[model samples]
Target chain A: MKFAIQINEGPYQHQASDSAYQFTRAALAKGHEIFRVFLYHDGVNNATRLAVPPQDDRNITQQWTKLQKEHELDLVVCIAAAQRRGLLDEDEAKRQGKDANNIAEGFRISGLGQLIEAGIEADRLVVFGD
Target chain B: MAKKFLFVNRKAPYGTIYALESLEVVLISAAFEQVVSLVFMDDGVYELTKGQKTDAIGMKNFSPTYSALGDYEIKNIYIEKESLDARGLTLDDLQHLVWEDEDDDWAEKDSIHLVSSKELATIMADQEVIITF
Candidate 1:
């Protein structure tokens, strides 16, 4: 099976991010193809490298960064949502006259069109949101 | 091939950002020329309600944007009847949304469909892709 994933909550404030991560892992474990993971709403916060947690706790952004590295997953953060939430990439930050960019490794900022294309191409579009 | 795409809006207008963000996605997807349908369930039905004045709340009044959806060439709008009844709302409470048919000399037609849960289930089951917000 081929799947496109969209997560719509912030990483720590909600469990949707964790659930989406687990579901992506489960799908990959079953040898299913993940077409893309498009983050929107507060979900773009998951791509912020500025998130720091206690040593014993899980680092949500790192987990996704590692998974993306291993699977070469196309992790996309919606540019409109990201900009609104201040999760900017280097280019986006520069374009917006910001001083810093917090986009984590393995994640890219893009337009909603990528999400629409994912829905068109993937066999199933799974939304992990509130 | 064009796929059957359904977007499910399950939240209210101002209390949460889901409704507006979901509308953004739907509007952007219109450029793709896909077969799209929208279902308003739960508090989402409030998004199409008439007489939304955001002046007191200091928020943008985006309720009128629902009427412009027909102009985007994307016109399927489904309102869950049970949800409406649960909220003490009826079809009359919503804005009169319509679309034009180029096939019939651009005749105006009703775009809003008041459907029961079972009817929505059938519409949902037939979709190739369903995105819930």
Candidate 2:
């Protein structure tokens, strides 16, 4: 089975991102294919490279980046939501005339269309949020 | 077969980014040509209420975007009647949303359906995919 995941909350503030991560990992362990993971709303913050956790704590952004690298996952951040919350990639930051870009590795900025496509293409669409 | 996609909105507008972000997904889902329906329940009913002014709050008022859902071929928009009553609102308080019915002599038809919570639950059960925000 192919699964598509939607994350709607940011890290630390909500358990949504963690639950989504666990679910994805478990699905992959069971040999299920992950179609895509589309971030929206506060979830876009999960893709920011600027997030830094304490030495003892687990870094959420790094977890996602690692998962993407190992699984070759399609991790997408909604462009509109990212713009509203200031999570920009290099191209978007330059286009918007910003000084810096913070999008983490393995995640690309895209539109909500990717989300809808995931719903249509994946066998199951799982959403985690507030 | 096109899957029945039901977007469940339980949050209020503006207080959080959920409402606005959910609308973006709904609009984009139209392009997939899926059987999409939106249910406004709980605080989500406030999303459809009229006369919203966000300039005072310094946030862009995106309420007008609800009216454009019809243009995207999304016609099954349901509002929980209990939610509206609990919030002291009625159909008159919401923006008038309509779509052109090609099967009905091309007449304009109201798109918003006032349904009870029970009815909304049944509608939810029939959906192949249910995304809540």
Candidate 3:
């Protein structure tokens, strides 16, 4: 089965991101194909490269990036939500006249269309949020 | 073949980004040609109330966006009747949302449907995909 995951909350403040990560990992372990991982609302905060956790704590952003690198997963951060929360890629930052870009590696900023497409293409669309 | 897609909105607008962000997804889902249905329950019913002015709150008033769902060919919008009564609201307090059915000679139809929580639950259970925000 193919799964598309939607994360709606940021890290630390909520357990949504952690649950989504664990679910994705378990799905992969069971040999299921992850169609896409869409970040929306506060969930866009998970794609910021500027997130730095303490030495003992798990780096939520890094975990997502590593998963993407290993599985070649399609991780999409919603552009509208990202802009509202100030999570921008290099191209978007330059275009929006911002000084810096903080999008994490292996995540691309796209539109909500990607989310709708995921719902249509994936066998299941699992949403994690408050 | 259109897949059954249910958008479950359980959060209130303005206080959180879920309502607006979910609306964006609902609008875009039309392009996929899916059988989309929206249900507003709990505090989510507040999203459809009329005369929402965010000017005093300093938030962008996205309430008007709900009216545009009809333009996206999205007509199956269900509001939980129990939620409305609990909040002391009625259909008259909500905006007049309607859709024009092109296939039916452009007949104007009410987009909002009032259903019991049990009925909404049944509707949700029948969906192939259920997305909540």
Candidate 4:
């Protein structure tokens, strides 16, 4: 099955993000095709690599980056939500005249159209949030 | 190919960004030319309420955008009757949303449908893609 995942909450604050990660991981392990992973609202916070957890705790952001790298996943962070949360890439940072870019590697900033396209193209569009 | 896409909204406006973000996705969905529908339930019923003034809250009044959904071909807007009754609201509490039927010489018609939970479930089950916010 082809799946498109939507995560709507930030890491640590809500378990939805972690569940979304686990679901995506399991889907890929089953040889299912992943259409895309869209991060919206506070979910865009997952794109920021600036968060640091305790040494023994799970690094949620890095986990996504690692999974994205291994699967070559098209992890998308909604640009509007990301900008509101200050999660930016180098281009967006430069365009908005910001000092830093904290978006994690392998996650790209895009518009809501990507989410719509995922709905249109994927067999299932699974959402995890409050 | 076009698919039946349904957006389920269950939150009140301003308390969280989900309501606004759902509308944002709805607008974008129009470009995909799919059969899209919206359902307002629970506190989400408050989202379609009329006379929403955000001046004190300092938030952009996006409530008017619901009025524009007709133009985007978002014709079916299901409001849960149970939710309205639970909140002590009637159809009059929400915005008078309408759409123009080109086949009928551009005559305006109501777009909002007050449906029972069973009807809402049928609508939901008919959709190929369901995204809740």
Fnat, model by model in order, equals 0.95, 0.89, 0.95, 0.95
Which pairs of residues collide in model 4? none
Q: For residues A12-113, what per-residue lDDT tens digits would candidate 4 score against the true structure?
A: 999989999999999999999899999998999988888988989999889999999999999999998898889999999999999999998889999999
- Cα lDDT tens digits for candidate 3, A1-130: 9999999999999999999999999999999999999999899999988977998999999999999999999999999999988999999989999999999999999999998888889999999998
Residues A68-130 of candidate 1 have per-residue lDDT tens digits of: 999999999999999888888899889899999999999999999999999999988899888
Question: Model 1, B36-108: lDDT tens per residue?
Answer: 8899999999999999999999999888888888998877899999999999999999999999999999999
Off by over 4 Å in 3: none
Model 4 ranges off by over 4 Å: none
TM-score of chain B of 3: 0.96
Give the fraction of true interface contacts kept by model 4. 0.95
- How many angstroms is residue A26 displaced in model 2 relative to the true structure, after the best TM-score fit? 0.8
State the local distance difference test value for candidate 4. Answer: 0.93
Work out the TM-score per prediction. Answer: 0.98, 0.95, 0.96, 0.98
Sort the candidates on lDDT, descending order: 1, 4, 2, 3
Error of 2 at A25 (Å): 0.7
Candidates' C-alpha lDDT: 0.93, 0.93, 0.92, 0.93
Please give the lDDT score at residue A101 for candidate 2: 99
lDDT of 2 by residue, A3-72 (tens): 9999999999999999999999999999999999999989999999998789799899999999999999
Q: Is candidate 1 or candidate 3 better by lDDT?
A: 1
Off by over 4 Å in 2: none
What DockQ class does candidate 2 belong to?
high
